[model samples]
Target: MTSPDEDRRTGAVHAVAAYGLWGMLPLYFVTLAPAGSLEILGCRILFSVVVAAILIRWQHGWGRMRTALRDRRVMLTLAAAAALIFVNWLTYITAATSGHVVETSLGYFINPIVTVLLGVVVLRERLRPLQWAAIGVSALAIVVLVVAYGQVPVIALTLAFSFGLYGLLKRQVSGRVDGLSGLAIETILLIPAAGLLIAVVSSWGQLTLLDHGPVHFALLAFSGIATLVPLLFFAGAAKRLPLAHLGLFQYLAPILQLLTGVLILHEPMPATRWIGFAIVWLAVFMLVADVLIVGRRGRA
Candidate 1:
């Protein structure tokens, strides 16, 4: 058997790799801009279905997939998760490709807080005082953004809430299905709608599928790998590591995304926006500290 320390070390590597890949997703979305967000979303769904199906086959999860398919409640939960993730994908792609990558990063920065709130309100989980303080500080950051920007940070909030809800729903059904099988089922559920939408886009002149030539077509197909591979790394990490460690590493993606936006992408960040982000960062720090403290206390 693998030693616990070795497993944790391996998990940390996988988690970092997963988040690093996710952080670079904005760069990937930039290349797909000609395809339009909806078209890219559709292609992502279709190709992800193919990729996830193959993974499920390799994992010998076909039997589990069939069982999950037969279960009404699990199907319903996955359907909800699928809808939320679709919204997340479309929004992030649109935001990133439209030069709103900074705001997109903000959404992810606030996502953990949103997830914690969902746990409290929807799942009836209790939180420590520091966690509540973190939530309050995060809310203040949102208000600051609204006042400073003269509009609510809708992109960030939408991304945060949609993904938080997606995670919550996935957690609910996590015990029932493995990651590949669940993802395969969810993508399979999306196929009909995605197919119809793609057909409609093709009927219009806007579809970039064949118009962009073979290279673009290849990129569209390769979206399957882009979508599934990081998730596979995350699944591996979750299996090998403690949840607390995994949770801490989740911040890496947003940090890299923020850097990509401000540094590499040349997105403007005014003083006010920077202040709001700083406050949000402080909130995240507090939340993380609380988690660490609580974990230590429990161990003691």
Candidate 2:
């Protein structure tokens, strides 16, 4: 049996890998050339479905898939999540490919604030001072961006809101599907539609992977590993760690994403984005700090 201490470590690691993959996704998605954003989306969905299917078969999750399918409400909730994530992926890929990495970075940076906002609106939870300040600073960043860029940071907002709502929806589903099984169910539902989209793009000679060499196919397949590994790790950690602690691990991804945008991608923040990021991060730091401190005091 896994020890609680081990579980906590695993959870922390899971959160890091999950978010790290998400942050580095721009690298994976943008590296494929000659493919439109939507085309790449289709390929990802298709390939993911194929990979999800094989994993399901290996894990003998067919029975679970059948059960999830019969459950209309649960299926619908996941479907909603799928739609939101699909849009999120597309926008992220487009932004990364289009040299708007910083814009994409902003979306993820503020995602935590978005999650807090959901608790306020949907869960009717009262925000702590740190939470409120986080929101306020995040709001200031948005104001700065709109004032300077003249266009709303729609990509960032879409990513933040959709992912926030997706998490909310996932929280509502009481019966936990194993990570692999959940993905299989979600991918199975999405496969037919993804096929149609791929066909459309292929007809237009727009699908990028078709003419690419073996290396391209190899990279595409890596996406399956990239998609699956962290999710399973998170599921593993969830079994071991308390929600209070596992929850904190999530910030690692966006933080890494922000770092990547600044250091690796070399995307400029300008004065506006720089100020915006500072405020947003300050709020998150305070909120997370409060959580950690309170947690330790409770233990004491």
Candidate 3:
């Protein structure tokens, strides 16, 4: 067995790797934009399903898969999560392609606050003062974003709510369905819908992959591995790290996204955006602080 220190280090690596891969997702999505949002989303589901199937089979997950599907509630929950995640993927790709990566980043930065609210509302849980403060700050950020953009930050808010609901659904899933098996179920649940979409696209001569060359083909393969590897790492981390610490590391992805949009993509941002980002960041800080403090008190 691994020593405590070794296990901690390993968990940290896995968590960092998982978030880092996610941080680089915009680059992968950018290459596929030529294919259209629907096609990209469909392909992601198709590819993710295939890869997850192979991994699950390799890990002797057939029995587990059968057991999970037998439960109607679990099946329904997974289906709901699949739909939410698909929406999240489509919106994210569209945002990146439209030069709104900065706004997309805002979604993630505010997700934790959203999650806290979800707990209070859906889970009927109570929150401490710090949690309420975080929620208020996050709400302030959205207001600032709307004022700055002269319209709603629709994409960012969509991403946040969809993902928040996805997590909420996942919480009700009976057992840990996170790694290969969990991901497999989510993808497999969507395969039928994705297959229909792909078939329609193919019939219309609009299936972009059929016409792509070596480079595009290579990127598509990379996307599959890239998607799976981080999920596996996250699964590993989830088993080893405290949930509170894991929550803190989740911010890394949005931080990278914001940096990429501003520095690499050269996306424009006005004064109100700065104010919005500031509020969002402050909210996340409070959320993390609350989690850590609660965790420490429990330990004490």
TM per prediction: 0.97, 0.91, 0.95
Best by TM-score: 1
For residues 27-116, write the lDDT of model 3, one tens digit per residue.
678877467666777777888877877888888888888888788888888888889988898899888877889988988887777888
lDDT of 2 by residue, 1-300 (tens): 878777677777777767677778777776777677777777777777777888778878889878877788888888887887777777887887777777777777777788889999999999877678778877887887787678998888998898888788877774755567666666666777778877898888777674788888777667667777777777766777777777777776776667767787787767866776777677778778868877898899
Clash number for model 3?
Answer: 1
- Report the candidate with higher lDDT, 2 versus 3: 3
Each prediction's Cα lDDT score? 0.91, 0.76, 0.83
Which scores greater on TM-score, model 1 or model 3? 1
**Worst 10-residue stretch by lDDT in candidate 1?**
29-38
Local lDDT at 294 for model 2:
76
lDDT of each residue in 126-191, candidate 1, tens digit only: 999999999999999999998777899899999999999999998999889888888888888889
Which residue pairs collide in model 1, if any? none
Q: Comparing candidate 2 with candidate 3, which one achieves the higher TM-score?
A: 3
Global local distance difference test of model 2: 0.76
| Candidate no. 1 TM-score | 0.97
